[model samples]
Target: MTTQQLHEQILLKKSFLCVGLDVDLTKIPEHLLETEDPIFEFNKVIIDATHDLAIAYKPNTAFYEAYGIKGWLSLQKTINYINEKYPDIFTIADAKRGDIGNTSSMYAKAFFEDLKFDSVTVAPYMGKDSVEPFLAFENKHTIMLALTSNEGAFDFQTLITNGTELYKQVLETSKTWKNSENLMYVVGATKAEYFTEIRKIVPDSFLLVPGVGAQGGSLSEVCKYGMNNKIGLLINSSRAIIYASKGTDFAEKAREEALKMQQEMEEIMSLKFKV
Candidate 1:
């Protein structure tokens, strides 16, 4: 999806919520295991239940990769289901992949072509060459890591080099890459205060923010400094929503959780943009 399309969805839904489909077999309802593909079944129900409450869905690739081939198949099926059933809903392969040039290109093709995700998260440690390949795909976004919500982010992302922080350097340097307009970013909601500085560097780029509910990051704090004129923020809530209840009513509970966030987002937009 193009940036305009994403903005339109946020406006139409009155939400920029991205539901993280970080499914784990052990945490899912026990009854789902009896089905042919428990992962896909679990995902299908969650998608059906909460698709309207969310504008995007991000399936972290690690969850699928852990189960090997069957997991990968489930991932494919999940993306296919979303594309076929809700084409307007933005999909993200939260793979956090970055490698050498040729390897990165193949990863790009795998997620962008084979799986057909509208966006994929990427680590920027390897620098521009590792990221440009993913940005090459038209209308497909490369969401580069910047100021993550994790405690370990302080280890490298904040290190100053020649008077500029490492994460800021990554944000500024990435703008010089090929097809940089297609670039978005991953800014953890835990570092909500940093959004003020981050926006100064990439004022218009979209940010895929995690670390909300389960991580205790406040949505109001994030939007206070992170929101832009177009409302460029995709705040994700994974465990808190998807695992709201591991019982048979898991999907319903997930919808309830998502609805709470969506309602909050609608109110935020109504006040911020007066829409």
Candidate 2:
């Protein structure tokens, strides 16, 4: 989806919530284990339950990769289901993939062509060549890592180089690449205060924000600083929402949790943009 389409979805839903499908088989309802594809079954329930409340669904690739071919098939089924049923909802392959240009192109194809995700998360450690290939795909977004929410982000992202932080440098440098407009960023909500500075760099780019619900990052604070006129923030809540229950009412409980966040997002937009 184009950024405009994604922004439209955000407005239509009154939400920028991205429900993370970090499905762990061990953590899911035990009853699902008996199902043919437990992972896809769990995801289908969550997506069916909370589709209207959330603007996006992000499936962290690791969860599926760990299960080998079975896991990958589940991931495929999950994305295919979303595409067929709710094409308006944005899909993100939270793969964090980046390699040589050729390799990145194949990775891009796997997610964009095969999996049909609207976007894919990428690591910036390999520089422009690695990311430009993903950007080459029209209407597909390459969400590069900027100031991530993880504790170890301080090790490099915040370090000053040439009098500018590495993450800031990454943001500025990424703008010079081919099809840079397709770029979004992964900015952690835990570093909410930094959003002001981040906005000054990429004022219009979408930010895929994690660390909100489960990580204790404040929703209001992230919006106060990170929100653009388009409300460019996809606050993700994985474990807290998806694993809200280990019983048969799991989908209902997930909807309840997502509703709480969606309502909060609606209120935030109402006050900020008067939408």
Candidate 3:
């Protein structure tokens, strides 16, 4: 999806909420395991229940990759279901993949072409050569990791080099890459204070923010600084939303959780844009 299309969806839905489909088999409803593909079944129900409440759905690749071939098949089915049923809903492959140039190109093709995800997360530690390959795809976004929500982020992302922080350097340097306009970023909600400085560097770029809800990143605090003229924030809530309940009413509970976030987003957008 193009950036304009994404912005339009936010307006139409009155939401910028991205439901993270980071499914865990053990945490899912026990009854779902009896189905042919428990993971896909679980995802289908969640998507059906909350698709309207959310503008995007992100399935972290690690969840699928853990189960090997069956898991991958389930992931493909989930994406296909979303594309076929809700084409306007932006899809993100939350695969923080980055490698050598050639390998990165293949990873891009896998998520962008074969799986048909609208965006994919990438780690910037490998630098421009590794990430630019993903950005080469037209109308697709490459969300580079910036200041993350994890405590370990302090180790490298905040380290100053030549009077500029490492994460800031990544943002600045990435702007010069080919097709840089297609680049977005991953700014963890836990580091909401950094958004002020981050926006100074890439004010217009979209940010896929994780670490809300279960991670305890304040939604209101994130919006206070992270939002832009276009409301360029996809705040994700994984465990808190998806695992709201592990019973037969899991999908309903998930919808309830997502609705709460979406409602908050609508209010925030109203105030930010004065809609």
Candidate 1 structure lDDT: 0.95
lDDT of 2 at 253: 96
- Lowest-scoring 10 consecutive residues by lDDT in candidate 3? 266-275
lDDT (10s digit) by residue, model 2, range 241-270 = 999999999999999999999999999999
Look at candidate 2 and give me any clashing residue pairs.
none
**What tens digits encode model 1's per-residue C-alpha lDDT throughout 1-275?**
99999999999999999999998999999999999999999999999999998999999999999999999999999999999999999999999999999999999999999999999999998988999999999999999998898999999999999799999999999999999999999999999999999999999999999999989899999999999999999999999999999999999999999999999999999998889
Candidate number that wins on lDDT, 1 or 3:
1
Task: Give lDDT tens digits, candidate 3, residues 221-264.
Answer: 99999899999999998999989999999989999999999999
Stretches of model 2 off by over 4 angstroms after superposition? none
RMSD of model 2, in Å? 0.6
**What CA RMSD would candidate 1 show?**
0.6
User: 178, model 1: CA deviation in Å?
Assistant: 1.1
Which pairs in model 3 have colliding backbones? none
Give the alpha-carbon lDDT of every model.
0.95, 0.96, 0.94
Per-prediction TM-score to the true structure, in the order listed: 0.99, 0.99, 0.99
